[model samples]
Target chain A: MRSFVALFRKELRSYFGSPPFYFVATAFLAYAGYYFHSDLIYFITFGFGLNIMENFWQILFVDLRLVLIFAVPLLTMRLLAEERRLGTLELLLTYPLRDGAIVAAKLGACLVVVATLLAGTLVYPLLVYHVEPFAFEPLFAAYLGLLLFAGVCASYGLFISSLTDSQVLAGFLTALPLLLLWLLSWNEAAAASGTLPVVRAISLFNHFQPFSVGVIDLRDVFYFLYATGLFVWATLRVLEARQWRGRR
Target chain B: MIRSELLTKYYGSVRAVGGVSFSVGAGEVAALLGPNGAGKSTVMRLLTGYVSPTAGRALVGDVDVAERPVTARRQIGYLPEQVSLYPEFTVRRYLGFVGEVKGLARRRRRAAIGRVIEQCGLGEVADRHNGTLSKGYRQRVGLAQALLGDPAVLVLDEPTVGLDPVQAVEMRELIRTLAGCTVLLSTHNLTEASALCSRVIILSHGSLVAADTAAELGRRLEGAGRLVVRIDGPPDAVAQGLSALPGVLGIERGEPDGQAGVRFVVLASNPEPVQRRLAAMAVAAGWTLLEVQVKPPTLEDLFVRLVGSEP
Candidate 1:
């Protein structure tokens, strides 16, 4: 427990002290803010009879999730890759800490960063609330969904980071699979009607859609949590294998 | 305090360590002396629990590393050859992190950090960022991290590989001050091994070639004494004359003495007697004996002889 806290603190320091985190966070906010402002303008001008909660904030939440898919890879690319590249992983592994503790610490730090990034977008909800008060419960559910989705992305990104020492390669590889999973539901008409259900069922977009509508279905929550656990497990396995496969 | 029994590691088909075995008693300082690619780092890694052995056991304080790696690692302090540090972290912060990972209590962590800072002479640059520090300071910080928690065993790989002479000496001095700890360091430097370690474990091709004290290895490999003599005479006559001395096994012509004389290295069963006889013979034979000195065998000789004999 002590080792985990130490590693967690070190990893948090690395993220907060470095430029990449600030860069990714700033970029994500800027992108989300721009779209949120435009979406608000469109809602005010052409969104007559449209519900502010569903039409304004929910649309913004969906757009923010898209930005998260790209931002997470950038945030997690260096977690393990830079450690290996700098040869610090050997020292870290030799410490009196379990492999799972190390992985959990890194993943926890990245999740904190993800949460911070999502926190930056709270202003959009504030702006919507000022126009007309709405139910906070739905907004809370939407934010929860975004956080869960980001957690899954961060786990996969961290897993890929463990497999290579090149941050660029890790980032690219992580983005590729995430982008594919996000786009799986696209062009549904071209797919066989029978197989379309399976494709949508596995798609990250399909799972995240209910959260955008202020609905917290247990199935969607389970899907994100299960994916997060699976990738986190994969990362732990990779770390353990390094002891036998030899350091690259 | 540390033991390895037939410890072997293979990276796929390439064997990095092959059934090598050795032990360092409590409070003993030993050197893993080997050339590059001789598996010194691999052996250290195995012992430190950074990697598991393919076949065999590495024990620290009677705890098998493979069976209980984290428990065994708690008893070891390792300084890898490449002294890597988080560049963004200050020396103090990095050491604090290491102290925490070492499971030191908060108050104890502060004390240990301060102790190592003082012991390693890191007081001057304790606040400096690791990336901005000099190589010597970086190496010292590496040592400082290892010294945390005061583990029973210390595994240092090429501890002074990149430091200047002064820093190297300071590092060695700091290591020397580590009393009552089993220290096993690796180095290809013959002088360093002899200077810092009481026992030298010579490795060649991932196998233990010889393990003993430096002086003992030298004595065993010496077999016969050697003497270097400079004579102001014809090279051929000096060589032939030295061959005639009793107990002189052979004489090999050496480099010129830079002054009007020739040098010869005489191999003899008894060097002191041979030296006196050669000096007397030079005087009677009308050849000026400029210089004659007994030459003791060195660890370099032993290393070359042992490593060279390996295929």
Candidate 2:
């Protein structure tokens, strides 16, 4: 447990010590804030009388998803890929370090980065509060939605990083899968045909929809939890295989 | 303290190391000498637990590398052919990380890092990033990393391959100081083995072709017998006199001057007859036989015999 903590702190220090953390987080947060306000103003001019839940749902769908979907790949591509390219992975592996510790710390540090980005968006709710002191239940749900979405994406990115040493390849590979999921449920003809239930279930939109509304549905949370678990398990498997491959 | 029994390693149907068996005890430095692809690195990897053997067991302190890998790994410090380090990290940070991974306690880890830096001559570049250092400094840092936690055994693959002549000499001196720590380092540098190792293991085509002390290796590879004789007699007279004698194959004389003037590298079928002839000549020539010691074979002769003479 102590070794785990030591490794985690070392990982976090590496992230903070490099340029990627500060720039990536700040840029994602600023873009999300700008787009959410723009999205809100555009909806208002259309005379859309969105209540607290409706406004939160609208911000959640367009703003958070757009920024997070793009930002996640940038934040996580280097987690394992850079270690491999630079041969530091061997340095870590040759030590008394456990594979679980390495995977946990990498995912945890990315989550922390995601947490900082989510924190920056708190200004959105404060701005919304000035217009009316209505209940902000839906916005709170949206924040939870944001956390789960970021966590799930980060895990997927880490799994992809395990597959290749090139960070650019990892980013592209990760984003392409998420982009496909985002579009999976939207192909109107497939829904009409009622085929490909697997594709429909795998889509990120279908699972994230309930949270966009004022509902913290257990089912949607479970979907994100399962997504996070499956990829993290895959990440662990890949890391474990490295030892086998290295052994003559 | 270290042993490998019939250890073999394969890279997908191609055997890099055949069934090679050898052992090294504490207070001894053994050199694994081989040409390229002679399985020197493969053997080192198997012993270090960096790679599991395809068959057989490698025991470091009675911990079988394939059976109890972590324990085996903990007892050995390995420096691979390439000094693979975290380039972005300074030498100190890299060692600290290595210390933690090697399971050293915090206080002892610090002390060990400090001691290894001084021991490997890495104090000058302790704060510099490992990537930016020169080849000699980088090799020292790699050696420093290997020396961490004071592992009982060190497995260094080509530790001095990239150094300039002077640095190679210095690196050899450092390796000599590590005599108490069981070392099995492979090098093309015969001079290194000549100066440091007590027993040298020669591998050819992944087999134990020769295992002996530096001088023994020299003698065995010399075919029949050869001796370098220095006497206080005339060079031309000695060369001509020795050539006329039976079993005296050749004699190449050095420049003459005073008592130590006449010297030559001698080749003969049998060294005993040459010794007798030299003793008789010393008495008859009215000159003293100052030095009549047998010179061991040169490294080139050893390489030809051990690696194969056809090349």
Candidate 3:
């Protein structure tokens, strides 16, 4: 437990000690804030001031998904790649800690960065509540959806970071799979065909739609948890295989 | 406290470490001497559990490294070649992290960090970020990280590879202070091995060529000794007299030393006996013998003889 905490703190310090974390955070907030304001004003003038959560909340989440897809790669690219490139991974492996602890600490650090990036958007909801107090339950569900989505993306990005020592390659490979998953259900006609159940079951858009409408289905919650666990487990397996690959 | 039995490793088709076996008792300082690609680093990696051996076993203290790597690693403090470290971390924080990973308590981590910082001469750079440090300071920090938790065995590979003479000497002195633990380091510098290690293990082409103390290796590898003499006498007559002496295999005459003196290199099966004989013969011939010195073989000589001559 202590080693995990120590590793977590060290990774956190490294994330903030460099320029990349701040760069990604600033870009995420800039894009998210810009879209949030535009959508909110569009609802106020064009839709006669309906509940902000009903009109612009889902749009905010959709933009956040885009921000997450970009920001997650930046946050996770250096978790293992930088360590391997600098050759510190050898030293780290010699320490009296399990490989799982190292991976968990790094993943935890990435989630913390994602959380901080999401924290900046709390102002949008605060501004909504100040003008007209709306149903808070749906707002909570939407924020919950964004959190799970960020976590899932961060896990996949962490797995990709373990594959290479080049941060650029880790970022590119991480974004590629996420971009595909994000666009998996863009054609509704294709989604409503014979592959509807299978496509909807796997699509991030289908699972996240429930939370956007204030419906907390257990299946959707389980799907997010399942994806998070599967990727985290895959990351663990990759790290375990590294020892074999490292051997001569 | 450390042992390897028939240890071997192969990188695909290339053998990096052959069936090599050796052991270091508690509180012994040993050095692995070899050229590039000689499996020195591979052996260290095997013992540190950074890589598993292809065959045989490496034991740190009583635990086999491959069988229980985490348990065995708890007893070792390893500083790899080139001294890789996180460039963003300050020296203190880096060592603190290492201590924590080593399972030291919070209070103990603080104390260990302080002790290693003082022991490694890192007081000046304890708070400085690693990326901003000089090469020498970075090596010191690397050493400091390895010293945390006071493990029973220390494995250092080329601890002073790129430092200037002063820094190298200081680093060696720091290693010398670690006298109560089993210290095994691999280095290319013969003088460093002679200065810091009590035993030397020489490797060539991924196989153990020789292992012994520096003096013993010198004596065993050098079958014959050499002596240089400068005599103030007739050159031919001096050479003839030296040749007449017993145990002198051959004599080569060199340029005169002026004032009617000559220098001769006498190769003998035993230089000590030949040196005494030449001094006595010089006295009998009324030759003014300016110098008669035996050239003792060094570790460098043995290394060159073994590594340079290996095909």
Best candidate, TM-score? 1
lDDT of each: 0.87, 0.77, 0.84
DockQ computed for model 3 against the true two-chain complex using alpha carbons: 0.48
Q: Which one is best on DockQ?
A: 1
User: Over the stretch B1-311, how does candidate 1's per-residue lDDT look in tens digits?
Assistant: 88989999998888988988888899999999888888899999999888899999999998999899999999999999999999989999999999999999999999999999999999999999999999999999999999999999999999999899999999899889999988999987788888899889988889888888766776785556778778998788878889889987666677764677997777676777788889899999899988788887566656655785322
Worst 10 residues of 2 chain B by lDDT: B302-311
Error of 2 at B259 (Å): 27
Least accurate stretch of 10 residues (summed lDDT) in model 3 chain A? A239-248
When sorted by DockQ, best at the front, the candidate numbers are 1, 3, 2
Clashing pairs in 2: A96-B101
What DockQ values do the models have? Answer: 0.62, 0.23, 0.48
Give the per-residue lDDT digits (tens) of candidate 1, residues A110-221: 9998888888888777766797777778888999999999989999999999999999999999998777766665667766899888888877888988899899999999
Model 3, residue pairs in steric clash: A248-B10
Q: What is the TM-score of candidate 1?
A: 0.87
TM-score of chain A of each: 0.95, 0.90, 0.92
